[model samples]
Target chain A: MSKPFLSIENMTQTFPDGQGGTLTVFEDATFGIDKGEFVCILGHSGCGKSTIMNILAGLAEPTSGVVKMDGFEVSGPSLDRGVVFQNYSLLPWLSTLKNVTFGVKARYPDWSKAKVEAHAREYLAMVGLEGDVVHRKPSQLSGGMRQRVSIARAFANHPKLLLLDEPFGALDALTRGTIQDELLKIWGGTEQTVFMITHDIDEAILLADRILLMTNGPFARVAESVEITIPRPRNRTDIVEHPNYYAIRNHLVQFLGQRSKELAGQQSGGEPQSPTRVVIDKTGPAPDPEPTTKPQLRAVND
Target chain B: MLDNLSTNQRAAVLSVVMLVVGLLIWEAAIPAQKAASELTEYERLTGGGAPKAGVPPPSQVLAKAWEQLSNPFYDAGPNDKGIGIQIGYSIYRVLTGYILAALIAIPLGFLIGMSQVAYKAFNPFIQVLRPISPLAWMPLALFIIQDSEASAIFVIFICSIWPMLINTAFGVAGVRQDWVNVARTHELNGIKTAFMVILPAAAPTIITGMRISIGIAWLVIVAAEMLVGGTGIGYYVWNEWNNLDLTSVIFSILMIGVVGMLLDSAFGFLQRAVTYAE
Candidate 1:
């Protein structure tokens, strides 16, 4: 296999409890993502998925680990990594256009005004927001609309990596589905690398090139990295009829169920010993399968 | 939705209804409202012989007001400054004092509010001086400044500071942590974050404090002018009282109420303009 684009090696993080005891969240966890890969991480409530994302983004520190992107170690957040948060973190005082353009202006201050506006408008329209709303403040927008603005803002800069921490978690089911479809469409066509955290099984299967599952914490580790076998441009409705869909879903369900049982037992003192080896299902074949057709990757603005 | 009624119309309707009701009560209380005055002036109106007193009815007050308004500046000659001049003078002083208080108070309050160390250092001094009355400052201001206008202005400045200062501090302190985090994520350092994010986020509270300060400023001005003896509406009321002209005194009091109402309404509009309601 070719060298991975982003790599996290032996990452561990701990915090002092202020009572002379230390709380360890992750321990020597290692993972790597290839260029333009879309990965979703699924975990239970205390799984430290967000903590891992924060460390990868350089917003938080791991006790011991190296996060390397394209062979360069990440010391802090940079324009190359754009993050979209769960609550649609659009600055309320700025108009939709300004919010979207904020990143562009900061990252490319030398760009012409027309260039900046065109760049921002392209992304905003890609996210399905009309130009009329470009001048309106975030407070004037609905929740879903605000989240779309956030997505537009994140994607406008054309970052090398997009990090989403349950970006649609606060939306209604219908809204979430619409957003999920939009996100898949945007990510699929662009070949943009995405790393997201979610608890929803359907969301993971629908969007991810691969899914990383984590065990529950005080000490969590990447339990498995399951590759979705369903073909490209995967439709949620059609994928259900695929031969391996149910089998993959059942495998994930059982894996999570067993982990939940283990976590419960450990909490209740019903089990003492730690599980020696974590099984991360890579689904079918071990390396990636060769493509038989010309990939139809399209940049969002185009 | 009643979109036909603009915000101004709604407020105007409510204000008009309140004013009418107040006028009716004043009319009804004419006898009682003037009872103290009528008791003393009974001998003169009754030709020094009777108990029946002559307390002017509400109609008589209006007649005098209308008579005065017909040629409002006849008493002032060609200078021709009607009640508007008195109002203008009072407004000028209030604007100067209130603006000075806001300019000084807001920054000071923000500093104290943002830093726990500054808050501890200044909190005691604020607590001690805040409760001291504007009238209490009048004598000291008069002696130090030795100018009636300056003294009255100083008194207003003292009276208005506490509310504005406290409100600014509260506003700055109450800024949402989420907003701060967003600012931090954008690489906005401390000063840029404070002015760009915190100030706007806390604007509503700061404006509310300014509203309270303006009200106090209006309240302080009347008393300050009365003590310092200036050419303000307060002094006009006092001058009328020395001549025993009860109607002019009543007229001046009405003017003060109207001016205060206008000042309050203007700030209310400003408050609504700056707020971005979540």
Candidate 2:
């Protein structure tokens, strides 16, 4: 089979548990993401979602295995992979315009002063940060606006892989809803490949083309790849009304609330643990393709 | 009427009231001098009527201020240099030594802040040396440098260096890792990262250090010039004491205060410039 644009093979990470023993966070985990795909990884805390994101960003290394993008092995952080951290990590000292321009200039150093500025302003405008608002520092901005600038900064670079580690985690639900809509607006046109970690099931469904569900850790692994069957141009209000939305969400909710823990720490015997492929479509006549999962559900039912 | 005034205007009114009250008391406290006509000829020749040698009243000091300020740069001899020239010399020494200290301390502090090993290695020396008085180095400095002027500068340099070095290291070391990670993901080189991310993040802290250093430098220069004893405001004050010119001493003391306040406010402006709310 042809390799996907980005692939992880047998990734494992362990830390000395400070008692002269090792604690394995995750092991023999594997996955692949095709170009232009929006993938979200969902798990309860401590399932090593962030560790996986870090490894992909080149900010960290796993104890074993490798991550390759575009036919080459990933190493230390590069401009190609941009991250929007949970804390909104906008440089507090710079104005809104300069923060975006700071990244644009670094990514395109050869661009002229005016061109760099115009490019930055273009992206800033995309996030609704124009006029006097761009001149204010991050500290001067509200939490939602700062995140918008951070989003602007990340998107302006047009990175090969954009990583969002719960970028809206710090904002209130109201503000979160607004930025999510704004994010959807910007992301629709960019077709940027995204890998995000989210705790919100509704959010995972709202934004992701596919949700990669992780089993609970110490031997946690990517357990299932669940595709969102609802057609796109999806909105927060409209998506919940779709027949397939709840079908996909319920399957995810069951796996997370039950199977994730039941399946935790079961190191599969001597093989890479690729997630099972799942497709849920209640819109039409019942058609389940993966017969292997039927008995597993039966066992859980019993 | 007071209720109608703004806060700053109210404060200004209070300050003027306090000044008038204090100056009136000062002017009233001196004993009255007997007229020359009332004194015996022997008392006159023997100078029993010499002006009382005590704290000069504000009026006398004011008059002296007008005289001295009118030709502040005039130079006749070492003992009689103008207030402006004397103040100019002191400022020159302070700034020279301060700037020298900054040129070395800032970069060194950046190095120490960036490296845990360097910070640990240098901590012992800084702890041991920082508390020793800058004046205590004078005898050693004088012997080695063999020039009083340079030794005085050296004193200012030593006194000013510690605060700057320590503060820079602290500020630089304390910069958030998030910012650094941002730099890395941007593919910024080491130089660019240091300039773009690390410097601005640490700047408020570093400028705080600089403000402290300048204050110390100003304080030390006065004492240092007193020890070296030739051509500064410190020396001028001492020289006036020797001449028993209480009025000039009082005036120069005020000038010292005025100059120090200016230096401090200059840094205050810089600190505000670099400060961010977060």
Candidate 3:
């Protein structure tokens, strides 16, 4: 296989467990995300999902491993990787448009002020933030709107990789659906590599090209890379109609519900633990897709 | 009629009534001045014709205010300067000292706030120095600076520095880690992050500190000027007392309170500007 666009090689993270023993949040975790792929890692709390996300974003370092993008080792935060934090970390003092422009200006310093502002307004528009709404500070916005501004800020920077730590975790179901759709639409246009962490199984299935299932900590490991074979434009309402949908969903549910705990706290014995690839396909030749899965079906040909 | 007014308007009306009532009570409480003819030979011989040194009525103080305020900037001689000129001198000293304090405090506060080692190291010194009265510094300042004017300003500076420095450090240290993480993820350089993120994040608290410092400086300036006794409103009050002109002294005291309120409200406006709801 070709080298992935972004790769974490044997990344381990441990903390002093307060009794002179080290707590291995996750050990010898190895993963690769292909370019233009939307990958999500789902595990219960204490599984070190956010730790891995922080490592990938270069906001934190792994205990004894490296993160690389485009074959360059990542040592610190860069414009190449943008993060949408879990709490919708938009600067409260800046208006929604200025928040986007803050990142845009940093990413493209040579760009003119007018260009930066226009670019900010455009991405904000994509997230359904426009006009007066864009001028409101984050505190003035609803939870969903704040998250949208955060997403707009990240996307405006055009980072090679976008790291989202449960972007929809704070939203209600309806708001989550709307923002998820907007995220998918924006991601479709940009084709930027994405790595996200979420606890929601349905959200993972709906958005990710592949789902990386992580076992629980203190010896957490990435156990499986489950491929979501549902074609785009996967509809929130209709993706379930696809034959591969429930099969993949059930496998994920079974893994997270049963196997995650069963496989928890296992040492890989100094071996780099990569996920076992599991692809579920129930389509026959010229398999039919539901008409509602439009924009268009990127059919996984059987 | 009062029921039709808004809360603020009603409160204002009540304030006016209280002021009038207070003035009427004050006017009535003063004993009638002894007639010059009723004074004994000894009192007359000792110049009892002059107004006795006592708390002047509000009406007398008001008349003095009108007289002094009419031509405040007249500088006839050293001890006999106008109220305007005296207030102007006091304001100059307060602002100069306050600005100098801010110049040193804010940047130093940021440094201390950003580093745990620096914060710990500076804490003892701040603790020791902050509590000493600004007036206490006057004697040492007089000896060292050797100029009363500079010494007065120095006293104001020393007095104002503590609140601003402590508050700034607190505010800067208290900036949310999430916001700093946002700056990190954006790849902002240290300076850029400080100016764009940390500064704005800490500004409200810093301004609060500044408000506190300005109030302290205003309070200290009066006392410092009294001790130094050169050209401030504090000196004017002292000089009026020495001359036994209680009307002028009361009027100067009223002027001092008005000026302090104006100074504080200026910072109040600034505090409101920088404040953001989290």
Candidate 4:
């Protein structure tokens, strides 16, 4: 198999618990995201999902292991890794347009001011914020609108990878749906590699090509990487009806509900194993039901 | 009667009414003139002929205010300048000192806020020095600088520096981590992040510090000028008091209040400008 475009190998993060003992947030977590692939990480709180995203973004260093993007070891924050924080971390003092322009200009300093502004506006328009709304400050905009600006800013930089830390966690259901669709539309146009962290299973199914489920922490590991086979241009309304949807959904729900807790109790001996990969197919015939252990499906013809 | 008005308007009307009533009572309480025939032999011997030596009536103070204001900037002589010139001197000193304090305090504040080591090292010194009165510096400043004008300016500087320094440090330290993370993700360097992200984020708090500083500076300038005995509103009040010109003293007091309010409101406007709802 070809080398993954973004690889996180055995990353462990620990903090001093102030009692002279080290508190391990997560340990020996391993995952890889391919180029132009959209991957979402699913975990309950305290599973170190944000810590993993922060490591990928280069905002924080893992206590051990490395994050590699485009074959280079990530060290610190760079424009090549764009981030969309859940709080819609737009510079509050800048107008929406200026905020986007600020990043665009930083990315392409040689570009003319007009060119930078035009590029920013284009991204803003892609996120459905156009005309006068772009001139308003984040304070003047609604919460959904602010998040849209943040997405626009991240996309406008044209980073090699986008790290979204629960980007829609704060939005209501309706707003989340709209922004998710907008994000997918934008992602479809660019084929951007994305690593997103979220607790929402439906959102993961809606946006990601693959979902990485993380077990509960202290020594948490990425327990499984569920490959989503839902076809492209997928609609939220129609996705659940796909034949593979229920199989994939049930597997994810079962993993999160019971398997996560069960795996957390099972102490692996040495270095943790890579997450098991599961593939779901809508048109393929079902394999014989194995009453012993979970059946691993055969690789499909792409 | 105040029911139809907004709260501020009602308060303003009440203030005016209270002022008028207070003035009438004051005018009535002090006899307009001493009864010349009822003067005691001791009063006659003591030459008590100084217009009864009472607080000047409101009408007299109002007349003096109009006269001084009509030619505020007139500079007949150092001691005989118009009220405007006196106030101008005081404001210039306050601004010069306040600006110098800002130049030193803001960058230093950023350093202190950004570094725990610096904060720990400097906090005790700041705590000890901040509470000492600005005028308390006047004697040493005069001894070293040996210039009354500079001493007055130095006093204003001492008075205004603490608030701005503390507030700026607090504001810079309090910038949201997420915003800083955004700056880092954009690959902004430290300088750009400071100017573009941290500065704007901390501006409102810094302005609040500035507001407090200006109010204190204004207050201290009056006292400083009084101590130095130079040409300022504060000095003018002292000089008028020495001359027993109660009307002029009252007029200068009103001017000081008005100017102080203007200085405060200017900072208030700036604070609002930088303030973000979030």
Candidate 5:
């Protein structure tokens, strides 16, 4: 990929045991994210998605290898990398305007007070908050409103890279859909690179330019990189009409299901697992997505 | 809001009636002789006769209060200085001591809260000093400062510092790690992050501590003044007892109660003003 904007190479993380040995969480893990790419890392529980994110954020150190951003070694947290936490980490004492302004003032210290405030207000409005509502504290706002403010604060800085650790995992399905739309709209408006961790297959399929599927446990690695060719301005309601959408979704489902089966087989060496893979036209007529066809698993004879 | 208040008002009115009835029963239960004893004591002062035994009236004390309250700034006699003058002197002492205490205590508390090493070093000293009564400080204060007014102020200072200090420390310590992360992610450096994030986040708890400090300050002031024998409502009550002016003594007691209530209310209002919920 001509040296992606961000590159992680041979990253291995090990936690030291009190007894002289080390527990390896991931080994030789590697990935690269290009500029303006929306990448979702998906895995089952305990796959070290958060661990990898923390490593990239410089909150935690990896045991081996390096993470480079724009061809510079990642050291500590930087203004170049903005993070939106899943918990909506809005400081309660500050009003929405002040909260967003806090980020702007820090990143752009040379900017005058009026300029900082105007920038904050513009971002708040971009996230759909009106002027009257901007004055209210986080406690006074609803859950969704708080998350919106969080997004505004993160995006306001226009950081070179944005990391979201399951930002919408805590919301309800309906709220999740609404927020997903908002997120897409906001992403469409910006050129920042995004890497998000998600458990929802649909979310990964809908939001990402590429979905990085991870294997289950201790030696977790990106098993597959699925490129989504779904057209631009893709609305979720109409996304199903894209022919490859069903095939790609089915492929991912089949991949995850088989990965689970392979692990189970490794433990017992029972059946010959054959995970069925769907190959369909990337540019062809779309059919109504069906739920009846359960993705069949095929064996990869390791 | 009006519609929401009807039931609340009904409950409040019911409680008021209950309180009034309880007071009436208390008044009725007092024996005639005891009532007369109370009035006789009241009568001994102000050169006013005791009320009828059955009903110990408030008019006579009210008149004495009015006499003291009117021209509240113009000293008419040695014992007849305006109530406002006395109250002003007391409030002045309290403000001087309390503000001084807050100024020192809050920042110190924040520092202690922020650093484990500082907290470990200073916490023992705070624990030891906090329990020593403000009244106990009175004797040391008198011996050192030598002036009753200064001693009284010093005692108030000692009494008020601990709550604010502890609260400030706790508030600062309890600020969320997530907020700190946000500040760091935004590239806010140490001092700026502390000011913009930590201080504001900890303010509610710190203010609550101040409220408690104020109430304690008011309570300690009366005792401090009484021990120091100064020109405050506390001293006024003690002086009347010396003069066997029981009515004046009771009046001073009422005045102390009212002033204490006002101080509490003032702090309560401040707490509300500063609070912003998450």
Candidate 6:
């Protein structure tokens, strides 16, 4: 296969456990995201999913390994990789227009004030916020609106990659669905590469082109990559009725519900092998056309 | 009349009524001074007929207050100026010292807050110097500076610095880590992040510190001026005391209260301006 647009090469993260011993968060986890691909990582809490995202965003460093985008090694934060934090991380003092403008101006310093503001307002309008609401501060907006502002800020930079850490995790279910639709619409038009971390199985299936399932940590690894076979223009309401939806959904739910904990306990003492690829049947539940071998597990050193 | 008043208005009316009642009681309590049978040598030397022990009646204070207010800007000499001039001198000293403290404290505070090394190195010195009274520095200031006015100003500087310095540091350090993360994700440099993100986030708290410093500065200036014996409101009060003129002293005390309130309210306005809901 040709080189992916973004490559995570054997990234490992460790922290001191405060007893003069190191705690491994994850070890030698490897993955790659192709250009313009929408990928979601699914893991239970404390599985080092955010740690991996942080490394990709260049907000943190792995214990050993490198993340390269295109040809250059990622070192620190850049406007090229925009992150949408779960907390909505809007600078509360500024209005929505100013908040988006702040990032746009930072990304394109040569752009005039009017041009920057117009660019920011365009993105804000794309997220369904316009008119007087764009002038309101984050505190004045509802939780959903604030997240939309964060999304606008991230997209306004026209980043090469978008990193979302459970962006809709804090919103109500109704609001989450609406924003998810809006997000899908935006992503469909732009074809931006997205790496989102979410534990919601259906959300991953609906939003990501490929869903990466991670085993539970301390020696956590990406166990498998499930390719969603659903067709485009999928609706949250109609997507569930699709023939392949339950097959993909059941496969993900089973891994998270049963296999994740089992794999956590099964590791014996060597390096973790990279995740295997699993292609779901598009028509209906059927035996795999090609048999894929399970990854070799090893004992973990404590 | 009381039915339409809000809680604050009712409270204000009660305060005036209480003041009137207290003044009435004071007026009735002191009997018209009896003719003096014998005067002590000290009393004769100072002033033969001045009331020695009784608190001055409210009527005499009111009359003195009116006289001072009518010609507040009069400058008779260095030792004797009108109430307005005395107040103006006191305000000038407090502002000069307070502003000097802010200039030094704010930038140092930002440095200490942002750098762990600076915080660790400077914290002990701040703690050591903070608790010493501003007036306790008056004698040293007077001896070293050899200028009473400068000493008083220095005393105000010393008293005001701690709150602003400590508050600013606290405010800066307490800025949300998520906001800093946002700055980092945006690739904002250290200077831009500090000025654009941290400063606004810490502003309300910094203003709180400034409000506190102004209050302490105002309080310290009075006692410092009293100690240094300069031409300020404090000196005016002291001079009136030497002549045993309780009415003028009482009037000046009221003036001091009014000026302190004005200073505090001015800072309160600034504090409100910078305050954000989130």
| CA deviation > 4 Å runs, candidate 5 | A16-22, A258-302, B1-57, B76-80
Task: Give one digit per residue, the lDDT tens place, for model 6 in A1-302.
Answer: 68899988778888999999998888777788999999999998888999998888888889988889997899988889999999999998889899999999889999999999999999999999999999898999999999999999998898999999999999998999999999999899899999999878889888999999988988788988888888888889898999878878888878888888888733424564567887766674556545454322211121
| lDDT: worst 10-residue window of model 5 chain B | B48-57
lDDT rank order: 2, 3, 4, 6, 5, 1
| Candidate 4 lDDT by residue in tens digits, A221-250 | 888888888989989999989988878888
- Better-scoring candidate (DockQ), 3 or 4: 4
Better model by lDDT: candidate 2 vs candidate 6: 2
RMSD of each: 7.4, 2.1, 4.5, 3.5, 7.0, 4.3
Model 5 over residues A45-84: C-alpha lDDT tens digits? 7767899888877777898878999898998888888898
Better of 2 and 5 by TM-score: 2
Candidate 2 on B102-176: residue-level lDDT in tens? Answer: 999999999999999999999999999999999999999999999999999999999999999999999999999
lDDT-best of 5 and 6: 6
| Tens-place lDDT digits, model 4, residues B12-103 | 99899999999999777766776767788888778865556769888888999889888888888767998888988998999999999999
Q: Which residues of candidate 2, in runs, are more than 4 Å off?
A: A268-270, A285-302, B37-47
Which 10 consecutive residues of model 4 chain B have the lowest summed lDDT?
A: B45-54
TM-scores of all candidate predictions against the true structure: 0.81, 0.96, 0.95, 0.94, 0.83, 0.92
- Arranged by DockQ with the best first, the candidates are 4, 2, 3, 6, 5, 1
Alpha-carbon error at A287 in model 4, in Å? 12
DockQ of 4: 0.81
Compared with the true structure, all predictions reach lDDT values of: 0.78, 0.91, 0.90, 0.89, 0.80, 0.88
- Model 1, range B1-278, lDDT digits (tens) per residue? 44789999988988999988887887787654334445556555665434344455566667766765665443374223466566667778888998999889999999988998998999999999999988888878878998889888888888888999999998898887657656655666689788878898888899999999999899878777677664677766777677666776677787789888988999899998888856
i-RMS for every candidate: 2.2, 0.8, 0.8, 0.8, 1.2, 0.9
Error of 2 at A259 (Å): 1.8
Listed for each candidate, the true contacts retained, as a fraction, are: 0.17, 0.79, 0.86, 0.90, 0.81, 0.76
Arrange candidates by TM-score, highest first: which order?
2, 3, 4, 6, 5, 1
Candidate 1 clashes between residue pairs 3 or more apart in a chain or in different chains: A224-A280
